[model samples]
Target: MREPYARYLQLLGFDQTPHGVEGLRQLVRRHVIRVPFENISKLLLIRRERRGRPTTLNEYLDGLERHDLGGTCYTSNPFFAELLRELGYDADLLGCDMTRVNVHTAMRVRVDGSAYHVDVGYGGPFYEPLLLTDSPHEMRQGPYRYVLDRARDGRLAMNVFTGEERVHGYLVNEIPREREFFTSIILDSFRPAATFMTQLCVFRYFEDHAVQLQNNVAVHYRAGESGETRISSMKEIREIFENQLRLPRCPVEKAIKTLEQLTGQDFFAMGEGDLYV
Candidate 1:
């Protein structure tokens, strides 16, 4: 495992031995703070997204391996556990069902008798792991601050303060690692009426902040200042492949054409888009 994850740890600036919860926290913080999540490596996989056959974790990793783009929470959380093991931290890879169409994978670490959710993956949900406690907290970083309040209803509610103001945003539930996790997320995603109200989003939570990417928008929220940047375009999604994410010449045209065909709209038109990212 050490040999396999050596390159990744080095890439994430965790090439040293990182023991205990603080170490794990630092490791995750480094990953999310550095890596920018993107999907342009579809060309490297050369496998098109087919109906009922979304790209799995293995495929995404393979795509990243081929293109040098790497992965976000979906692949990185499990990889984080591998590194923690090398550092002698008790960690495990757990799968949580967040929605019907999305099954999120994360790392659970127990260090110094306290458990923390270390997920540097899942770009739209969290950025680092959260201490599983019922509390209101703010994660503050330079020029960004994101807030989370555990609702009385036991729902993990959050809002991305986009500098200008607050907006109705993400709703998260911390599902346990269960055998039915995969199926549950699928059931939630495809239910008769889904209410996520965002694009196909993923998240990573830190102690006080979370980082997420919804479609082409990248949001960094902690506790003080916040940064929201338009990282992609619904109209120019094809260009995103060619520019920001850097996809192959083939997949760019293919994804755009597929999106266009599905929505009966121009692929480069931002005015017309779907909730799914």
Candidate 2:
């Protein structure tokens, strides 16, 4: 188990042995860019289970290769956690509901003593995680930012941002007892959410920025900038296969067709013209 996990670390550029806080930060920056935050495979897993089946790590890895991506916070954090354990770093996945209406999921991780509000899988710009500290602090990266504070009732309130507008992305439960209840929530995430279902999207953190391929658009986050680029359109969605994301045209076509077939709607049926324009 350690060998396979260690291999992933090598792939993620950890020094086989990271020294301390600086090393941990580099690891965070490294994997966010290396492993993709994706949902195609997660959606596939949900579908398979609905039909009374299961998926394996090999199946997931294959999906990672086929989709040209990995996963959102759910996928990226754990993948990062696994590799950290392999590299002997103390890490854990912090599950969050984004405490908002417009989005589905988000997570932050503490690789050593510090925290990072990682949402590379959320299909938009991401907020840097909060480093472990006593005082209040806020950080902004591209289109997203977060302020960390202890609520009166003793919760870690993350005041999230998308420019001047701000909302609660999530309330980090500071009660150690509460965090313990979700001991297995990590692997359980892949099993599917039985109560709610919706279209999935993600953003994988990269070295310089982050990459997001959702519904039909493939984009990359440019640092110090609030907007992202539509590298290819659903029209050029095939490029996700031929280009960087490595999604195969055939299966991707099948996935796209399934969505249209099931929902009775095309991507742009909402009346927006060329999304890239």
Top candidate (TM-score): 2
When summed lDDT is taken over every stretch of 10 residues in candidate 1, the lowest stretch is 191-200
What would the per-residue lDDT of candidate 1 be over residues 18-119, giving only the tens digit for each residue?
A: 666667667767766545444333222222433221345445444444543545434455555656777788777676433332355666677787766555
lDDT, candidates in the order shown? 0.49, 0.49
TM-score of each: 0.58, 0.67
Question: What is the per-residue lDDT of model 2 for residues 79-128, given as tens digits with 9 covering 90 to 100?
Answer: 55555555566555455434332123334455545665444444433334
Query: In candidate 1, which residue ranges exceed 4 Å CA deviation?
Result: 39-59, 68-74, 78-87, 92-107, 124-128, 132-135, 140-145, 153-180, 183-254, 272-277
RMSD of each: 6.4, 5.7
Clashes of each: 40, 14
